[model samples]
Target chain A: AQTVTQSQPEMSVQEAETVTLSCTYDTSENNYYLFWYKQPPSRQMILVIRQEAYKQQNATENRFSVNFQKAAKSFSLKISDSQLGDTAMYFCAFNMNRDDKIIFGKGTRLHILP
Target chain B: NAGVTQTPKFRILKIGQSMTLQCTQDMNHNYMYWYRQDPGMGLKLIYYSVGAGITDKGEVPNGYNVSRSTTEDFPLRLELAAPSQTSVYFCASRPRQGDYGYTFGSGTRLTVV
Candidate 1:
């Protein structure tokens, strides 16, 4: 069984600043996928960014990027130039390369302050 | 495109009542999943289907049942509803093998009183 952990239950960042949400997981599979999903008040889950374990270079999408340390079992999400729309419940998820099941973390409620 | 659609955006049920949460996808995805999200918490998988006529249990399948009659439709049924069953349910679909992310529905807010 794989478990994803987001230590921070809640975090706040000032507008136009950068913020990082920490995530760690326990998995024995050599190849897997890590993802960060955002859910706003609308309760719609939106994919933020994803990282493949085999890739050494971190994945960057617009202002969202990930710091994946496979050896340390850590995958953190970084939001640069944060905006108010970035405020949401962020979840870290994990799934094996061949598995259809995705394990999710408790989530961190992020608030972007203006 | 209506990627994923879940009916009855909000539903309330009494104890011992039974109801089905309808989910349908237009992407013709082979993999579909049902998950529940408690207030201020993350999501827990209830069940999943790899394709039509194939379904399996997930982390939290108790008090729930699911049937996959087609590649685009996966419905979750709850029998004898309890207060503990009150949560937001989500349906998602994705390709069996791909780097693509799952497309989630807006979710159904279910309240069991």
Candidate 2:
């Protein structure tokens, strides 16, 4: 079974600053996919960024980027030039290439202080 | 694209009551999933379907049933509602082959009293 863990339950970042949300997962498969999702107060889950296990370069989406360390089983999300809109519940997810199931972590409540 | 659509955005049910949470997707995706989100528990998979006529239980499938009779619809049924079942349910769909992220619905908030 694959399990994702987000150690930081709550995090806060000042506007225009940078913040990183930590995430770790346990998986035996070498080839898989990792994802970061954001859920605002509106309750819609949006994909922030994604990283492929075989890709060494981390994934970057505008102000959202990921630090994917496959060896450490760590996939952290970094928000650069953070804005108030970045405040939300962030989730880390894992999915194997061979399976249809995607496992999600508990989530990190992030607040962008203005 | 309409993506994934879940009906009855909000619902309240009494104990022992039964109801169905409807889900449909227009992307013609072959895979659909049902998940429940709690305050601190994140999202737990309740059921999943690879395609029409093929369904399987996920991490937490107790007290719930699902049927994927068509490619677009995957409905979840609750036989006897309980307080523990109170949570926000989300329906998601993804392509059968690819690394594309799943498209999630707005979610259905169900409160079991």
Candidate 3:
């Protein structure tokens, strides 16, 4: 079984600063996908970024980027120029190449201090 | 598009009671999923369907039942609700592509007293 782990339970970053949420996973498959999803107070799950295991380049979406170290099985999300609206519970997810089932980490509660 | 929609946004059930959490999607996605999110805990996959007729278990599949009769609907049934089952349930759907992401429903907040 594959499991995603987010070590940080809570994280805070001041406006205009940067913060990184760490994630690690255990899987035997070589072809898989990694994702970061955000859940705000609205309780809506939104995709932040994603990285394919076969790709060497990290995935970046505006202020969000992933530091995907395939060899280390580490996928971390970095939020730059944080805003108040960025405060949310962030989750790391995993999906296999041939399956649609997604496994999620516990989550990291992010607070953007203004 | 309506994306994925879940009914009974909030519900309260007592022990030994039963209820069905309705989930429907308009995107015509071939893959659908059900997950439960406990307070401060990450989402746990309960069940998932590859298409209209194929269903499979996920990370946590106990105490739950699901059926996928069509591509747009996948409802989860709880026969004997328990306090341990109290959590926010979310439904999500995704395209068949490996690079595509999932579209999640607003979620149903269930309280099992």
Task: Report chain B TM per candidate.
Answer: 0.97, 0.97, 0.98
lDDT of 2 by residue, A1-114 (tens): 788999999998799999999999998899899999999999999998988899999899998889999889999998999999988999999889888888888999999998
Return the lDDT, model 3, position A6: 93
**Residues B23-68, model 3: lDDT tens digits:** 9999889999999999888888899999999999987899999999
> For model 2, what TM-score is found for chain B?
0.97
The models' CA-based lDDT, in order, is 0.93, 0.93, 0.93
Candidate 2 wrong stretches, greater than 4 Å = none
DockQ of all predictions against the true structure, Cα-based: 0.66, 0.68, 0.67
Give a tens-digit lDDT track for model 2, residues B1-113: 78899999999999999999999999999999999998666998999999999999998999999999999999999999999999999999998734778999999999999
Worst 10 residues of 3 chain A by lDDT: A95-104
Residue B96 lDDT (model 2): 76
Clashes of each: 0, 0, 1
Q: What TM-score quantifies how close candidate 1 is to the native fold?
A: 0.97
Q: What tens-digit string does per-residue lDDT give for candidate 1 at A1-114?
A: 788999999999899999999999998989888899999888899999988899999999999999999999999999999999998999998888888877889999999999
**Clashing pairs in model 2, backbone N/Cα/C closer than 3 A:** none
Candidate 3, residues A58-101, lDDT tens digits: the string is: 99999999999988999999998999999999989998888667
The residue ranges of model 3 lying beyond 4 angstroms of the native Cα positions read: none
